[model samples]
Target chain A: MLPFARVTVIGLGLIGSSITRAVRQYMPSVRITGHDADPQVRETAVRLQLCDDVADTPGAAVIDADLVILCVPVGAMGQVAGEIADDLPADAVLSDVGSSKETVLAAVREAAPHALFVPAHPVAGTENSGPEAGFATLFQHRWCIVTAPEGTDPLAAERVCEFWRRLGAMVETMEPAHHDRVLAVTSHLPHLIAYTIVGTASDLEEVTASEVIKYSAGGFRDFTRIAASDPTMWRDVFLSNREAVLDMLQRFTEDLTSLQRAIRWGKGDELFDLFTRTRAVRRSIIDQGQDDARPDFGRAHD
Target chain B: MLPFARVTVIGLGLIGSSITRAVRQYMPSVRITGHDADPQVRETAVRLQLCDDVADTPGAAVIDADLVILCVPVGAMGQVAGEIADDLPADAVLSDVGSSKETVLAAVREAAPHALFVPAHPVAGTENSGPEAGFATLFQHRWCIVTAPEGTDPLAAERVCEFWRRLGAMVETMEPAHHDRVLAVTSHLPHLIAYTIVGTASDLEEVTASEVIKYSAGGFRDFTRIAASDPTMWRDVFLSNREAVLDMLQRFTEDLTSLQRAIRWGKGDELFDLFTRTRAVRRSIIDQGQDDARPDFGRAHD
Candidate 1:
């Protein structure tokens, strides 16, 4: 049986569009309604025919939706939830694909008291954004964490989990605060570090911009890909998950300083041991099928 | 015409094995000889037929070769150079594929003062190491910076450049010190940061290693690929290029601190601006063909 009969997705970006496409592919009878604050994106969605209906307002889109997912930046969650509150079906399962769960859950709860809120974060995305950049298979083999707050209806949460499963995701449940902490280390800190390093490389007076780009294949190019991810989304993530992100950053900085001292003091043994240990972590990731096993992520040579 | 009739690679690791394979593919008539300090690696090279002859000793490897490239760690360059010095052909042009040029050049000069030295660094590799991890097209369209010291034979430097070109690499000439500085930002510092962050994530008490590995797709996996690179080679790179790597690390840390502050203060505009600027660098890298243009380094979704 289909988990959701009528789905409404607010903020038609990569994740929003992918949900619509996956629902079409996996649950053909279900209806999809998408809405975006940006008229340009809404127009693009309409032109792309991403949904059964591209509603002009968030409230209009969720008026009859069995499942309403907010796909906007975490900072906008409250406003978007408030916008859809009056028209949102009382029985609808409210969910979101936000990076930080605690803040998003609070924002949604404050804005729509009657809604059955279940927050989720799909641990999958490329550096690209926008409706046009998504595909139906993006969630396949990827983990989707469902952080339904206390008192959330079990049926509503199960429906959300089932909805993701049908769309090709492996679902796991976690506390909202735990989700924020875990993601803060795995996702938030890495993005912050990538952005910092790329900015540092770009502003170097000795190394020209052209030189950095030309020789980036060495290792810098990998960071650039991560750093190129949507700015507004990342800005909101860092702001919304401030405490956890800050804690991770502090730990990362201390670790970086130790490595710096090792290099400065010519401690080859220390560097080698850490590097060897890290290699095992990578092997485990590959063994668990969490990452591409092929060398250079199977990048084409030609 | 071929750049060198007889080529000897004095290390059977990824870079050395790739050179032999590239030579066989691009310059078939060039006789290839190889050697490695580790007996197991030499046996593996022989088993893989990575070279026409797997010499038991470095001296034997370069006995009659017209060109000998040292593909050992930067810290081991002098020892390897000294090992080959006794039997190195008088007309042989000595070069190396080490990450840091200045240190390798100085070490090679100190150990083999009579040899015609031309230091070169091929800015290309996968995280995997050893003979089996290499391929004939590993150097295709990659940059190989040649840093030949002054008062050296220009003909020998040109021959080194021509040899890399034959191996399908684009060659550029730069001063030894400048090459080290450019690569410190482009390669060495990035690897150090990756190694540091992976270590930081691994040692976290709140976040388990499995959790980090499971959710690594967020951004951390990208760092792992770089962190998984050969330990000895990277150790030598950091130690040998200490000054420049330290300088770059200092700059990266300062930038990271600023970003941390912005996040703490909720300075969205500052974070947004830097993230937006870094996005352009990724585009330029793609346009210049320095990296794969596809999203997520073109990682396979399935």
Candidate 2:
């Protein structure tokens, strides 16, 4: 571990504070700094021991740092990049934990053209956010996806991978476009469905809505887990990755319609086949140890 | 409690065995008997000590019982009811633990018109189902929805409500038709969406599908949770509750299209506003003290 000498983590929210906590635990001797545009987060970061030094501005935080990680919502990557670009030292390994690649990369490239930027997203988070929600083990057993555009410096990407490896994450490399398409099906579209359904439930009259909550096991609780994710962060994801998300949403909608039609026509086999097939994926997740048999105790917040 | 003298439970599966385990804890002297069409469930009931007595058939289980709880899939309720209808004692307080109300009620009326049948659904479950999965507190703090048709005896409904209350559940009453509609929004639609999304994910080429599971936190994980639920049980739910489910699904499809359009147009505010509104319902579940935050641990079979 490079001790991430003079590491600057932008945006002291859930992911930011978590990285801070993990660094404090795993690399105690390293000098760590945190920055956030929000005044409250800065104060909270100081109170929560999230950093050795709290910087009021992104430029101050990134100055001469070996690594600068943009931890803001996907929509704000550009603004943060613009703020810190001038202060970012040469040879610094710049990276991001943003969900969408194309949008985040576009922003970083536009602002810090000279920096060795490696866009990466670590797939782990709770529904909660802010400094207090940070935990050191949040990254444990999670996958960190690194999307480096063609012709990137191999050494820069390798260093970024090593950084995450130190943080206790499994790493994989892929093209940015592949990341977006896969995430569109895996993350973006699923979020859209969850949000829409939860919105639909919320729109119900208060009485029925109350019933919906009380009897959430009727299936509504599953949607709520996805729906409870950070609104600003997800909004930025949808807006930034609009085309791919929309494209995946189209496929999902068509598939859902056919399912609806099957149910309407009392196609027992169709419903059974689909339901049966879906179970194998869940089984595979468990078989791979990606999922545990433990109930939701580990996810109390959700 | 009545000690539920001679309680007979049909379908010694997850819910049935759980009811037996719960009843044993709360009413230990009840002499709970269980019956299942599957021999494995019967054997597991014995191995797991979920019931005091194992009956050979539904009729044998119902013999001399004060309370007979039907714990079969929605589709199997009618057959079980028919098998036990002739053997049920005149004063038996009958109830069911099926997810759907209308179809189950219709079958009960057809098979056991003379028996005092009350339709009930415990809004609690795990991804895994079996006698071995039963726990004494399975219904603790969960909601139990009861739907009693008009002209039905009030005493029967009250008995059913008291029964669930003893098992540590709060009860809500509604008409069967209304229960089906509300559940269509709360449970059925969310489940269908999950199954569909998981199915789409599994259809991805092998490499991407594995990555999808490995990096599931991006939202696909929630769908997988729901998709992991019992295939036969869920299939029966969709088939038995076809019209209401399809209706809600249609509404969901329409709402999803509108969301797709918003994502396509990069309407960040629209997405944020919708996502923000979805949190309240989850808050309500937490407020109701029904939200089990244990992740997959508290609910699924380990």
User: What overall lDDT goes with each candidate model?
Assistant: 0.92, 0.82
lDDT of 1 by residue, B1-302 (tens): 88899999998789999999999999999999999999999999989888899988898889999999999989999999998888998899999999998888888889999999999999999999998898999999999999988898888999999999988999999999999999999999889989988999999887789889889888889999999999999999999999999999999989999999999999999999999999999999999999998988899896
lDDT of 2 by residue, A73-170 (tens): 98888888988888888878889998899878988899878878999998877777788877887787778999999878998888888888888888
Ten residues in sequence with the least summed lDDT for candidate 1 chain A = A106-115
Clash counts for all predictions: 0, 14
Residue A18 in candidate 1, Cα distance off native in Å: 1.1
DockQ of every candidate: 0.90, 0.57
Q: TM-scores for all candidates?
A: 0.99, 0.96
Interface RMSD of each: 0.6, 3.6
Clashing pairs in 1: none
| TM-score of only chain B in every candidate structure | 0.99, 0.94
| Regions of model 2 farther than 4 Å from truth | A1-3, A205-207, A295-302, B1-3, B205-207, B293-302
**Model 1 interface RMSD, one decimal:** 0.6
lDDT of 2 by residue, B7-101 (tens): 88898777888889889888777888888889888888888877788988888888889999988889888888889989999988789988899
